[model samples]
Target chain A: MDVLKINGKEKEFTAGQFPATLAELLEQLGVEAATVVAEVDGDIVERENFARTRLAPGGSIELVRFVPGG
Target chain B: MASIDEKLRRAVVGVAGLGGLGSNVAAALARAGVGRLIIADFDMVEAANLNRQQYFLDQVGRPKVECTVENLRRINPAVLVEAHNERLTAANVPELFAAADVVAECFDRAQEKQMIVETVLARMSPKPIVSVSGLAGYGKSNAITTRRISPRLILIGDGQSGIDTEPILTAARVGIAASHQANAIIELLVDEIKASAP
Candidate 1:
């Protein structure tokens, strides 16, 4: 099993098996309902594949959530 | 002061929803010479919109975005225009704002306005948003004020004023509110106000 450091949290999961959608990863991370936006390396991941997308080892991710006000 | 030509050349503005406020906002921006604009609205003109919208009776049945682009083009043929004939939602907001130097939230629905603001703020989109609220019924011009919710967010309209109660139709009130919005945007483009300026 390997871990992906997301934003700052390190999540450990079995290596080699990954979801086909990025949305699935969000659900696994308990962040599907968090108004989360995914940015892989410096570009944003389109919503079309968020649910079926997966992550690879050493691929950095940034999950942005909206804050109330402004 | 930056010349009108210089001010327009560097601006990439987005106006969402073309109604009383949005229509006036778009027209004012065009008249002020904004270099580039992205206008989005899925609505079509209704007979009821004859009051404040800068549209004629002949424009009825045309898409708001299309009509806005047409009207703006006629006003300033040299300005660049991109019209999106779609609703503004969370899904398309990012792409809509990706190249925008500034954004205006003209949605009459408070919920929609909140959604757009939250998304822009969350993404740290780097452009300022000029938002509207409380311009429903107008009696006193002094009631309107532009408040800075953050360094990058400016809110127009009167505090605690609801659109439903005010019954917006006349061009006067909507025009005032739109002017405030356009003024804030011009100030934003020319660096007249610091990000810290309220």
Candidate 2:
């Protein structure tokens, strides 16, 4: 099994069961890509590049969204 | 000899909205003796904004950027303020904020906030941006806080209390978040100074 840390929490998945790309992971998590910004392993993944950025085992990802109003 | 406060006075801050968060953040920075400010907004003041925004009753119907400039100057006459009376778009963010040392994302809408943040991150890489989220309604001031997302990005406000909730936005809670944003900017500036020091 492989694991990915999301927003500071660890979630485990079978090997090769993890989403192949950041975009897929976001979709699996039901997060609207436009509403949140994501950083994987300390590097920001630009919105347009989410699909091309691959997720590796033991990787850390942080997704942050706006709080609605100022 | 230049003091640390004087170093703050030498930095330029760009504020992208003049509503609740932007206005209050600008005012806080001005009071803190920040040297220069470049503020932008296209909306005029309305009675509805008086609840949690910085403008007074008399300023309603006036342009927010104009009122904000006047108020900022009143707070610190020595501070230089450049007011832009126009809406911010991704196309103009780089040009408008070219002179800013740090940019504050103070928009009201989620899409707009995302737009500004994306624009800044894409176009102005490495420039620090202090933004807010979730500071809506009253009570539980402790809920509002500041989080550092990256070296260039900081998020402020209670992560959960948004406008979609029950109580509604008020002066106290919003002010707390605004202050947090302002203080975060100061802390970032101090860190920058230290990092650049010999």
- Score chain B of each candidate by TM-score: 0.91, 0.94
Worst 10 residues of 2 chain B by lDDT: B189-198
Interface RMSD of structure candidate 2 (Å): 1.3
> In every candidate, what fraction of the native interface contacts is reproduced?
0.00, 0.67
Q: Which portions of model 2 show Cα errors greater than 4 Å?
A: B193-198
Model 2 chain A TM-score equals 0.91
Docking verdict class for candidate 1: incorrect
lDDT of the structure predicted as candidate 2: 0.85
Error of 1 at B96 (Å): 1.3
Off by over 4 Å in 1: A1-70, B1-4, B192-198
Write the residue-wise lDDT of candidate 1 on B1-90 in tens digits.
Answer: 556567567677888778887888888888887778888889999888887777889999999888888899899886788889998888
- List, residue by residue over B1-198, the lDDT tens digit for candidate 2: 456687788878999998888999999999988888999999999999998899999999999998998888788998899999998998899999988888999998877887788778767877878888888988888988899877777888766676876468888888998899899988877667332232
| A1-70 per-residue lDDT for model 2 (tens digits) | 8899998999998767799999999898887788777789987777889999999989999887875776
